[model samples]
Target: MSESKSYTGGCACGAVTYRIDGDPMAVRQCWCRHCQKLSTGGPTHNAFFMADAIAVDGTLASNAHAADSGNELSWYFCASCGTQLFGASSARPQMRAVRLGSLDQAHELQPTAAIWVQEAPGWVRIDPAMEQHPAQPPAPPPQNQS
Candidate 1:
């Protein structure tokens, strides 16, 4: 995707900024506990982005953690300000998890799926139309490796 249709976002303090181009691959809610704590400090919520569709700038802070699956998940946030921007798994090296709330037009992006639904709290109600998976789905088969 070229830089034609741009989406601008920044941290709460404006210390970090970035832009994304093109439509995202999947906009969905995650019931993963990690997402709950990261997004709202509560139950998980919907966020959207395509792993390969975003081109971002501005050096954001990052924290790497060993997820429940034992893979390292790197979370990117504002270095100057603690604003979580995105996350990624080394296992799924090709994609990114962008914070939909940071989008310039967040209302336009609605969730399509809900992963890790078995962990979803009782209070968090989601659309029944969404396809709910109980846990992190199997990673896509590797296409490039030496």
Candidate 2:
């Protein structure tokens, strides 16, 4: 069998670092207002992976709030530099969304879908090739058990 891919990244101030031992289940660009605010007016790119596949090596600060979809969302960041690292939704507790920008520059992941597009700003231009969802989509399929 082929070896699973590994990815490593850290917060801007180097106060937080993480490693993932498997491939992402999905990568998406989220245009939800909450995500926009976190991204400073742009969409947040994230790669979703099984929570069990990730290992974090630093203390992280986090905030939790109810999202428009009514899911309890929690975001983790670096306390020193405030760089967003990961986001988790109560709806999918077994998964974690890792901010694409927080990953090492060499990582090749890309958003294949754009979600919550109805809330995107008028001036924003989403790639036409990506799958679009006007609001929250169904959860990604569960990881294989093998």
Candidate 3:
């Protein structure tokens, strides 16, 4: 839809290089507590993308945590500098939540939505135009039927 969109990113050390073929999902700033704590900046903002749409090279270290959905989310970070790069959830195996800061054009991405706003600090404000979901989006319709 966006002129065959494409994007690229990598780890802090640049050992790992990655690419995305399509437009990102929700380019938003997440003010959730976990995000605030884990993020180097004031809060954790990211440009989410479909896992299937991403092509990554190199390696990364991950830490799994229980997400609000009661599923374990694998947070992939650079083993070298501990820079969080992306996240993948077991519940939605088809999506990869890439940290916006890790992208080559991070500033170009503007958040279109907000999630977990309740946890957002008072200092942060979000646009009302974006859709706000209490938690991760519902799973897309099952592609195959048993």
Candidate 4:
């Protein structure tokens, strides 16, 4: 087990901000087409954490879409910078996905898995050491306070 200190972050324009505590349950590099659309044709490096562990501030613009799993997913972004910051999904109400790029400490968080490998473009190279999955990886354990 490992422990990470609380961290604060925001969008590039500082219009939307967040303070999150506790280590993330998982960090992933997702190559789904939707992810590629979000990241300009690259994987989106994201971290999943319990919703209770985070506090967000400032106004945001949001959009809803269906994920590859056919679940409703809503993303919140900074209206000023058009930077996507966080995501909430109907399939995983207890968890929220934070875009790693928005985190001030993103450099320290590494993707432990690469998902949607089958959808990745041939030119993209994923780390050989990372766990790869054709689709979504197995669900992570629920957050535990004790």
State which candidate has the highest lDDT.
2
Q: Cα miss at 11, model 3 (Å)?
A: 1.9
Q: Write the per-residue lDDT of candidate 4 for residues 1-146, one digit (tens) a residue.
A: 67767878899988789999888888998898888998999998888988899998988899999876888988889988889898888988889889998997645788989999999999988999999999877777887757
Work out how many backbone clashes candidate 3 has.
Answer: 1
Q: Please, what are the lDDT tens digits per residue for candidate 2 over residues 1-146?
A: 57899999999889899999999989999999999999999999999999999999989999999976788999999988899999999999999999999997697899999999999999999999999999999988878866
Error of 4 at 21 (Å): 1.2
From the highest TM-score down, the ranking of the candidates is 2, 4, 3, 1
Which candidate has the highest TM-score of all? 2
Measure candidate 4: CA RMSD.
1.9
Q: What stretches of model 2 exceed 4 Å from their correct place? A: none
Candidate 2 matches the true fold with a TM-score of 0.95
Model 3 C-alpha lDDT per residue in residues 1-146, reported as the tens digit of each score: 24748889888888887898877656766666778778843656777677777888888888888877688877888877788889777887887888887887644687767777877767766678887766555543432235
Candidate 1 at 63: error in angstroms? Answer: 0.6
Pairs in clash, predicted candidate 2: none
Clashing pairs in 4: none
Q: Which stretches of candidate 3 lie over 4 Å from their true place?
A: 1-3, 106-108, 127-146
User: Model 3 residue 28 lDDT?
Assistant: 69
Candidate 3 TM-score to native: 0.79
**lDDT values, one for every candidate:** 0.70, 0.93, 0.75, 0.87
